[model samples]
Target: MPHPILTDLETIASSTAAENGFDLCGVKVFTHLKPMTMQVQIRHIGGGDVSLEECASFSAPMGEAIETSQLLNEAYVLEISSPGIDDQLVNDRDFQTFRGFPIEVAYRNDQGSELRQAGLLHKRSTDHVHLNIKGKINRILRKDVIAVHLTRLKG
Candidate 1:
């Protein structure tokens, strides 16, 4: 979990992002590093990808919002970026948006080894997700999904 201040910052940033046609994908505050950094990941509202110019355009207001909020105690690097093609499936919207696309899901076994599956997203329900792995259909409960990301973007 992030600090309460960071959560507040995310809420503020989300509003700013929405007004400028952007989706605030994620926010992180790295306090361990020498100079703490606040990384903000965003995507274009229309979808596909986010461009460098779009990130630049959103930076000013985002920075101003952070400053005005008085959330940070010292200087920090505000990184604005696209969530990218490999963004983790964090919510229902993500599962629905990438439906029918290729996703690689992975989980850990009892021995701590990682197992992965790659296939088309066949279905998503209230409790489980179906993936067409090879020619067979595999159903995995939502709680068991350790990691899910689009593999088609990997090249």
Candidate 2:
């Protein structure tokens, strides 16, 4: 279980993010830096890309706010960022918002088989998604899509 201070910090961060026009904001701590100095990542709720300018704008005030607060100590370094285009589709909200955009899903077929499918997002409900495949141009309902992700299309 996380300490109460951590939870409180999250709430503060969420509120600050909303006020700063960030759709999503999160804090990450790393015991060691492997590929980068600080492993901090922030992304949109629907997995859209965030620009470097946006990152700077979002992080500055947030960092200041956290620093001034008495709740948290200086144990973790803050890294602010935006989500990349090809991130995983985590929630139904993402699927709904990205409707009509290209997406990929891996699901189980009607015959109890596994399948990988990619196409435009037709619709997203609570537990299922309707996908419009590229060639067929018809929506396929996959109830057990184990993973869904947004596919970045090139111009």
Candidate 3:
């Protein structure tokens, strides 16, 4: 289990991100760094790429909140950014929001080699996803998809 402090930090970060017109994607603490660092990833609530200016704006208040709450005993580096176009489709909200978009799912083949399946995400359910690939509807379990990423189209 993650430390309670981490969860508290995530809450504060989430509130700050929401105020900044973003959804809190995730919060991570990297203890391997020299002074330790906290990374807070955010995504635009309405859907779009988050710019560096937005990250800066979001970081300032989040840092202040962490400092005010004394969430960390010592100074910790804080980083903020969008989850990026290729971030994994982990949660149901992600699957719903990205429906109808082209995505690439990496799965293990019979030989255990990594195989990729490209398709348009038609829909999703609690346990599986419906994909339109090669003019056929392929129903795949969420677990079968090792990684699901948005496929950036050339045109």
Candidate 4:
């Protein structure tokens, strides 16, 4: 379960992110640190890439909103960032969003040997992941998959 404060902060962050043309993807509040810490992850609307300048541009308004809310009693650190280009595909949304994009799948074969395959993401079923390599479709069992990651190809 998340702390109540985190929930409230997420609401505020989400609102702020929307005002700045971003979608709030994640939020974390750490109270264990000396002065506390808040980390926010955001992505541009319409699945566009997020730039560092955009993150910096958003920080000011977001910080102002947090300050105006008076949600924190003490000093805290606020870090804003994007989900990143090379982030692993971890959920159904990720699979859907990156459909038809290049990806690398790492999995274990029947002999327990680790293998890797790269291709255009086709789709993910309940029990398998399908990839289009060249003109052929390859399907790997979900249970045997280790990780699926977005890959970049040099032009």
In the range 65-113, model 1's lDDT, one tens digit per residue, is 8888888879788889887667787767788888888898886656667
- Once superposed on the true structure, which residue ranges of model 1 sit more than 4 Å away at CA? 106-116, 152-155
Candidate 2 residue 104 C-alpha distance from true site, Å: 2.4
Clashing pairs in 4: none
Pick by TM-score: which candidate is best?
A: 1
Kindly list the per-residue Cα lDDT of model 3 for residues 10-128, writing each as its tens digit. Answer: 89998988887898988989877878899999989886778999898888888888888887997689999887677778777788888888888887765678878788888777777
For residues 1-155, what per-residue lDDT tens digits would candidate 2 score against the true structure?
A: 43446566676677777776665534454445442223335666545677888888877877777777866444656778765567676666666668888888888877878888778878876646777775455444546777777887645
- TM accuracy, model 1: 0.80
lDDT for model 1 comes to 0.82
lDDT: worst 10-residue window of model 2:
31-40
Indicate the worst ten consecutive residues by lDDT in candidate 1.
Answer: 146-155
Q: Kindly state the number of residue pairs that clash in model 2.
A: 1
- Per-model C-alpha lDDT, please? 0.82, 0.67, 0.83, 0.90
lDDT of 1 at 91: 68
For candidate 4, give the lDDT: 0.90
Residue 89, model 1, lDDT: 75
Better of 1 and 4 by lDDT: 4
